[model samples]
Target: MFNKILVANRGEIALRVIRAAREMGVKSVAVHSTADSDAMHVRMADESVCIGPPSSQQSYLSIPAIIAACEITGAEAIHPGYGFLSENAGFVQVIEDHGLTFIGPTAEHIRIMGDKITAKDTMKKLGVPCVPGSEGGVATLDEAKKLGAEIGYPVIIKATAGGGGKGMKVAQTAKDMERAFQTARAEGKSNFGNDEVYIEKYLTTPRHIEIQVFGDGKGRAVHLGERDCSLQRRHQKVFEEAPGPAISAEERARIGKVCADAMADISYIGAGTIEFLYENGEFYFIEMNTRLQVEHPVTEGIFGVDLVREQIRVASGLPMEFTQENLKINGHAIEVRLNAEKLPNFRPSPGRISQYHAPGGLGVRMDSALYDGYSIPPYYDSLIGKLIVHGRDRPEALARLGRALGELIIDGVDTTIPLFRALLEEEAVQTGAYNIHWLEHWLETNLGEA
Candidate 1:
């Protein structure tokens, strides 16, 4: 096991990693920007270093500054807790080159899976089902238009190296395809440094389901089951639930086996997620997240597995402690992301929180670093915390989540808590009949209502 590790991110996830490391008797090093001088992660870790200014390019994403911090603190490994440089293959390689372990996947695996084109082709070779469309990236609008025609209308143009709903556009007609294709390409180039875009058929009313897979360095891998990320807004997940209510026992087995086989075939290591779009009882591979997802806590709540700890253990050359048989779902778990933003009209509301209170009690877990008078900087992600709840079943879980959300109190900034509270009361959400567009539609109908 590593004696010390450096966390290369910020916010609640950084704090979450610090607590996990403490439990295992591992010292933690936190590297923060000037803007995060008073951040909770810095205060909680055994050691903290200021990397750079508030801008991500000079700070959180700065490889040299982070590597220097690790060397100065004698940290043996770096844990990137989602976002920033977590999925950057080049960053992972740099860390290894500097004789530090990147507590995720090998650079080779990250390189292959980080790019959507290669990842999709690899999945196809492993017999994992993928959406029908282009075979590789389309360099020109003419190529995209041709592919769009072949795949029929209502196709999505996606960036090969994209995530977080960036560099993506949906085209419902040939005319829309021309503009969307160019726009997606431009955004991809600016956001990911890769303008490579691919075409995929868009499924109507699709449910977002992802299987969490973990592999030891020795080629052994197993899935922890599925999370229903169907509750999303603008193609980004806002809520997540484990043991997806939409999938059955047989479907779960099929999905799990397929994901494990795909990973084993590719020699994938560490923690990763294979996302799928489900519609009309069919699952189509969408993309793979090459790092730990932000919604991993809900899976931990249901499966009794500490995914971050497992990632560290795997990086340390330890074997997987359990097999597929040892993994079983216990109950329903739901996670609501508490973003520092407002609804109906999307905008960032960053300021010192006058009043801050987190929910507690049985089946409730809050992961955050916010407190009274803490200034939320708009220079980064709007997320402030994650509120996760577990129960015997979906209905029970929903009830618990509702109560937990009601108990949460945050002042001096507009939050999405009120929006989620309204969502919980929606009949469609209560019945598990909502799809990816449900939340956005609900917001439109109720955001401005009296």
Candidate 2:
């Protein structure tokens, strides 16, 4: 096992990994920007390093700064929690060159899955179902139009390297094709620096379901089932739940095995998530996240496993602790992201925390880095914490979420607590009858542009 691992990101995710490392008797190194010198993760780690200024590119996203921090602190491996350089294939190669372990998938795997086009092709070749679309990137407007018309109307044009809802556009008809295609390409070039784009059949009313799979890089893998992340705004997931409400036990088993077997065939290492669009009892591969997910805790909640620890163990060449048979979903788990944003508009609200109170009770877990006086920097993500609750079933979990939200208190700055509190009263949320568009439509109907 690694004696010390450096957490290469910030906020709650860094704290999440540090907690797991502490439990496994491994020292942790927290690298922070000068702006985050007083952050909770830095204060908690066994050692902390100041990488650079407040700017993420010069600090958190700097490859050399992180590598230098690892060398200076003698951290044998680096755990990239979610964003920044977590899915950067070149960074993985750099880590390998320096003989430092990367606590995630291999560079080859990341490179393959990082680009949406290649990932879809790879999955299709592996017998995973995919939506009808282009075989590769379309290089011209004519080609895009041809594929869009062939795939039928209501097709989505997506950037080959896009994420977080950027560089994606939908054309509802042939007349909408040219404008949507041009906008998508322009967004792709500006946002991702890649003009490459692909076309796919967009599923109306499809649910965003993802299967979490872990592999040992030795032809063995297991799935931790699915998370329903359909509730979103601008393609960013806000609420997520494990044992997806729409997926039955039989459906879970079928998809879980398919995802696990696909990873096993590739000898994939560490943690990965195979995301899909599910509609009318069929699953279509969307893309694969090559690193740990933001909503991983809910999966952990239902499975009773520490995913961060498992990631470290696998990167250290240890055998998987659980097999396919050993894994079983224990209960339903739900997670809501508490963002530092004003209610109704969801605008960023960053500032000091005059008072901080975490919800406590059976089956409620709060993952945050906030304290009584910690001033949230305006440079980072708006998400301040994640509140997860587990119960024997979805209703109990929903009720517990409602109860816990009331107990939690984050003062001195506006938050999304009220949004969630209002969301609980809706029958659609209670019955889990909403699709991917449900939340957006609800936001418009009830709150308008939140």
Candidate 3:
């Protein structure tokens, strides 16, 4: 096991990694920007380093700075919690070249799965179902139009290197193809520095489901089941639940095994998520997140597993602690992201948190770095925290989430608490009947009332 590991991110996830390391008897090094001088992760870690200014490009995303921090602190490994350089293949190679273990998958896997077109092709070859689309990246508008026609109408154009809804456009007809292609290409180039884009058949009401799989880097792997992330806004997940309410036990087992078998085939190491779009009882591969996901806690709650510890153990050349037979879904878990944003508009609200309080009870967990008097810098993502609740069943989980959200409080900044409070009252949400587009449509029709 590594004696010390550097956490190369910020906010709640950074703290999450630090806590996990501490529990495993591993020293932690927290790297922070000037803006996060007083961040909780820094205060909690065994050692700390100031990487750069507040801007993420100069700080959290600085590969050189993080490597230097590891050298200075004698950290043996780096645990990129989620964002920033977590999925950067180049960064992983750099760390490996420097003889430092990256607590994630191999750089080769990251590179192959980072590109949308290559990822789809790989999954398709592995016998995982995929959405019909161009065989590879559509190089020209003419090619995009051809593929759109072949795939039928209501096709979507997506940046090969994109995520979080960026560099994506939906075209309902051939007339919309040109604009969609151009826009997707431009956004991809501007955001990810890649102009590559691909086309896929867009299902209007598909549910977004993802399977969580873990591998020991030695061809041994297991699946922890699925998480229903269909509750989304503008293609970004807003709410997530474990053991998707809409899927049957048999279907869950089949998909979970498929994901695990795929990982085993590739000898994939560490934790990864294989995402799909489900409609009419069919699952189509969308993408794979090669790192720990933001909503991983829900899976942990239901499966009673510590994913971060497993990730670290895998990186240290240890086999997974359990097999598929040892894993069993115990209950339903729900997670509501509490971002520093105003309800309805969802505009970013970053400032000093004058007051803060977290809900506590059986099966309720809050992952956050906020405290009274802590200033939330506007230089990063708006997610400030997450409230997770588990219950014996979905209905009980929903009820617990409502009580937990009501008990939580954050002052001096607009938050999405009101939005969640309203969502709890919706029958679709309560009964788990929502699709990926449900949240966006609900906001458009009910934001005024909310």
Whole-model lDDT per candidate: 0.90, 0.94, 0.94
Model 1 stretches with alpha carbons more than 4 Å out: 448-450
Per-candidate RMSD, Å: 1.6, 0.8, 1.1
TM-scores of the candidates are 0.97, 0.99, 0.99
Assess candidate 3 and give its TM-score to the true structure: 0.99
Expressed as tens digits, the lDDT of each residue in 68-96 for candidate 1 is 99999999999999989998889998998
> Which digits, one per residue and each the tens of the lDDT, describe model 3 over residues 66-127?
99999999999999999899999999999999999999999999998999999999999998
| Candidate 2 wrongly placed segments (more than 4 Å) | none
Using TM-score as the measure, what is the rank order of every candidate, best first?
2, 3, 1
Question: For model 1, what is the error of residue 51's alpha carbon versus the real structure, in angstroms, after optimal superposition?
Answer: 0.9
Q: Give the Cα-based TM-score of candidate 2 against the true structure.
A: 0.99
